[model samples]
Target: MNKRLVWPLWNLALAIGLGAFGAHALAGVLDEYGLGVYETARNYHMWMGLAWLILAVAG
Candidate 1:
């Protein structure tokens, strides 16, 4: 509930939401290669969000 955590938490939530959107809404829209790229970026985003969360908590 700390204000410092808000941005990191929001980033995490947005990453999750975007992942879900790509999986479902864009399933048929993107081809295999495009989907793979999207997944990779999403994974990175998720990881970065986690890192941010950790930094916010530790700092």
Candidate 2:
């Protein structure tokens, strides 16, 4: 793999890992709306991270 490829790959992995962690770790602690907000943030992070990865590889 290229050196430039590493950052996005790590970011994507981090986003997935963190999203999973947030989902489980905050399940009982946060209320429904709060959890929804957290999930939305996670989803945005995941999407943006993947986008960066794709852009990095393509550009």
Candidate 3:
């Protein structure tokens, strides 16, 4: 694997893991507003990871 891709892949993997954790482990723990916030953060993380991956691949 390319060294440039490692960080991006790790970022994406972590984002995915956190997303799953938030969806499953945190399902009943967080309130509606908190869940919304978590989802927003997760989405941002995922997007940033994707952006990094693209940049790593294209640059």
For model 1, where is the 10-residue window of minimal lDDT?
1-10
Q: Candidate 2, which ten residues in sequence have the lowest lDDT sum?
A: 18-27
| Candidate number achieving the greatest TM-score relative to the actual structure | 3
lDDT of 2 by residue, 6-32 (tens): 988888898889888888898889999
Model 1, range 1-59, lDDT digits (tens) per residue?
89989999999999999999999999999999999999999999999999999999999
User: Which candidate leads the pack in lDDT?
Assistant: 3
Number of backbone collisions per candidate: 0, 0, 0
**Better by lDDT, candidate 2 or 1:** 1
TM-score of each: 0.97, 0.88, 0.98
Sorting all predicted structures by lDDT, with the top scorer first, yields: 3, 1, 2
Q: Where is model 1 more than 4 Å wrong at Cα?
A: none
**Candidate 2 similarity to native, TM-score:** 0.88
State the displacement of the C-alpha of residue 14, model 1, in Å, after optimal TM-score superposition: 0.3
> Cα deviation of 52 in candidate 1 (Å)?
0.4
What is the Cα-based lDDT of residue 18 in candidate 2?
A: 82
